[model samples]
Target: MTFSADYLLDRIRLKRRLRIWQGIGILAICAALLALAARFDVFGHGDHIARLWVEGIIRDDVARDEMIAELKRDPKVKAVIVRINSPGGSVVGGEALYRNLRDLANEKPVVAVMGEVAASAGYMTALAADYIVAREGTITGSIGVLMQSANVKGLMEKIGVKPVIIKSAPLKAAPNPMEDLTPQSRKATEAVILDMFDMFQSMVMERRNLSKAEVSRLADGRIYTGRQAKNARLIDETGSEAAALAWLKREKKVPSTLEVIDAIYGEEDLWAGAQSAIAKSFFDKTLISKGLSLDGLISVWQPELK
Candidate 1:
């Protein structure tokens, strides 16, 4: 009898589901203890709630956006510090995120607390903040536009493969991946990139108060160290999450007693947690592989090559 990986995964999933209720029971016990301790004033400090952490990739999705919107509207939150650690993604993705951050800043003092890497579209999303706080060695910048495609014409010729297409205009599929790019097609692609780059430059200029020439100097698709970014006026300060929070309290005059709570994905919501755990379990058992494509555009942060 042969036992395949899929069969093993199915068995594991069944066992995991059987054990889930036990895990939930343990969680309930822990929560009860915490609640009892809090009721008894375990730390002797009064309850405080004002600030929270907004984490993860900012995309066109409604979940993250809705959470951000709710936090901005909450009266208890005096200020917001965005914990940004993304390498950036799509153009529309960056633009939508920037708009939300800008809107949040309008109501409260919003600061970007950058992590290890916040480049390209990441920096684009950070432009709307009142201040940008970065660690000493954070990687930032890479202000430019990029679009990539692979040409498989040579491979098709070698293997005798071809793609047939029907379109109204010749230019519609002129830059087909299975063929060489024509001059006209290359020009068209360059035009699109140039327009996006121009928009990025304009945003930086308007937000950072830099002249067009100054923005052009830094927009050469080069990333900079946190220290270098501060010197170049790209970032406001070099600091960690704690330092950013302290600055918000001192400089921004957020209430001293206000609590700094982390706004996690679940945020003590049981339904959300259950759904996430279930999805995670399913992926881990059935979909995870050694050579999965964890690269490409959507990654919030990626390491630079040596």
Candidate 2:
């Protein structure tokens, strides 16, 4: 009957689950209506601050880019706030997002509010914003780019299997995992990494207005706490979305009463609504089925197993 809070209790009473599902059904209905309203701009038509939730993995999203680009011309969108919560992803993904945000910033005020962890590419996205805020415990920075490859040459050799690679040039398939990494191939791969790192380094230097030496000192692929980041001049201050709004009101003169709308939640927000419903269903099936016995009554204290 007792278990961790973040995770569901190891054993759930069937009686409680019935009520939970009933409530989930109501939420599902409300979410649907909300999506329809958002799609049609039912509750949002006047001047407002657009909120872009940058969650999960960062990647090149053409549809999202197009939506953001449209904001550049949106007169009603008085300002934009980017809420970031990610551990970073591809270099090009971060670069494209940065450019798009910078373009938007040219026309309207843009602020970034970091969540739990916004490092690497996530940090790059924030750099494009006019101002940045984060929780005191948030993890920011980790300003670097990297490429990784795994080698199975030893495994292949042990299995008596050889790889036949045909390429136009030596550097074409430089880091093939099935083959030995020659000095030439290693040097070529390192060159690519260094070149990409230079791009990341330049972005930090130019966006933050820091000297090359200052950027080099901080961009050693290290993460800094929100407080440390402020002291290091990596971010403006440490706070939350409320702080971001206050800055906009003071500096950009954006009205605090303006309704905040989601920048990316348009016709496709139905999917987001459905995802919430589906997640609850998935959780019920996974937890209940695994924890139950043939008699539909099973209780064995196994916190580690759960």
Candidate 3:
């Protein structure tokens, strides 16, 4: 009986030791998993500032809008910094980005940091920010709308080709390259440009709190340096991204120590992007082959330096 009792006590001790080791292993695994989660922001568990880089030609993208929506929904994102570096692109692209950024601004503080060139639609995007910051030499402020068309009537005549069109109205196929543009069509095109320009001008006036005369002076399709823009009240300040962040900390009450992480949602499908590029190239080539240029509504600063 004494031997059996001693054996039972030994068995109890071993079982307790085994349970302790198992608990330690479980805790170690939990700690590792937690570290991984923090690193990847899986649960959005910590405070951070999101940096959104908008470089190259801007295009209207549904995926981009979705990503911005995600940024709005993220609780860990205390503020947003939009870094723009482009000569601008389609007016619709810039307008869409501006709208999304404004929506994001409603949820969190947002600032824009201009890079080398932020003109036309780029400037429009900057206007969406709650605060604007640009480098001293940054080229900006080509505020206007544009449309271009070409007349290939001479080339068509030389090639012995005849153009045919059947339309319900005189202006239905008004600006085709194979034909001449009527006076009525020219006036119609100008009207469209003017209407868009009005929208852009109004956006600037309201965003910058400038009077009509002030906006009129700045919105004449001229580029302005960052310093000039600041003087003209086109931008709020002349500074870099660091200065922009400092402003957020000092004025907006965001913590200065929060980590800044890039807000790249994910890489767009490679084939989709490639296919779009190919399609654009094909379209441009086809137009040129027919003695014409790409004609569309755009707000871009395409400078030809010689």
Candidate 4:
């Protein structure tokens, strides 16, 4: 009987220790999850305004789309400010970002704050917002589409080198660098550019409430200052981000006390930044070698040289 009692006590003690350790493990996991949720702002602690920044060339849409989706899912995010600073890039990239922002605007008031240069597709992105604000000297409109190709046939001939291309159709590789663009190929390319240009123009006219004649007058691939854009009705106001926030508070009735959080998507940690920097160097070199070919139509601003 004594032996049995001793054995039972030992078992009880072991079970108690096991239960304590298991509880600690579960608590550790819960704490880890809570920390992660806090880091990601998953807990709705306070009302906040999301600031989604579009800087440099608008190349890829993945990060921006993810950020937009996150903001959309967050109930604490009452409004959004889209800050744009870019000369623009691929038409498809810009269009995708614009649509994502538009979708976000459906749930919250979205205002655009233009930085130094928001031309081409950058300006198109601003059109997705409820209102646009820009600095007086901010460069804004370059409403057009452009397609360019280099012909290296003469260079190859001079170098006694030729590139042979095999295609099922004559226009399969039309406007190739190894040959001069045929009249048919040029016409086909122009048609594609014009179609993209028309889409851009229509979006601008519809968003800015500009007449077709007004759009025709301004959409000649011309860059405009912020003041000029406002005068032309391309932008709503000539101001900075503060003006945008004020507009949100007064017009949209967003609370002035709400916290503004930058929700821009990209690398956040030092290790990630280092990795991205290394990768970006290679990617930039590739783009330069390929003449920045985005493999589709582009809405980019290239200033004409006299």
TM-score of each: 0.74, 0.80, 0.77, 0.79
lDDT of each: 0.71, 0.79, 0.83, 0.83
Candidate 4, 262-294: lDDT as tens digits: 663565554343333334334333544334456
lDDT of 3: 0.83
Best-performing candidate as measured by TM-score: 2
Higher-TM-score candidate of 1 and 4: 4
lDDT of 4 at 292: 49
Residue 195 error, candidate 4, Å: 0.7
Give the per-residue Cα lDDT of candidate 3 at 42.
81
Specify the highest-lDDT model's number: 4
Residues 104-130, model 1: lDDT tens digits: 888888888888778887888779888
Which regions of candidate 3 fall more than 4 Å away from where they truly are?
A: 1-40, 43-45, 269-295
Off by over 4 Å in 4: 1-39, 42-45, 268-293, 304-306
Clashing pairs in 2: none
Query: Candidate 2 has what TM-score?
Result: 0.80
What's the distance in Å from true for residue 172, model 3? 1.4
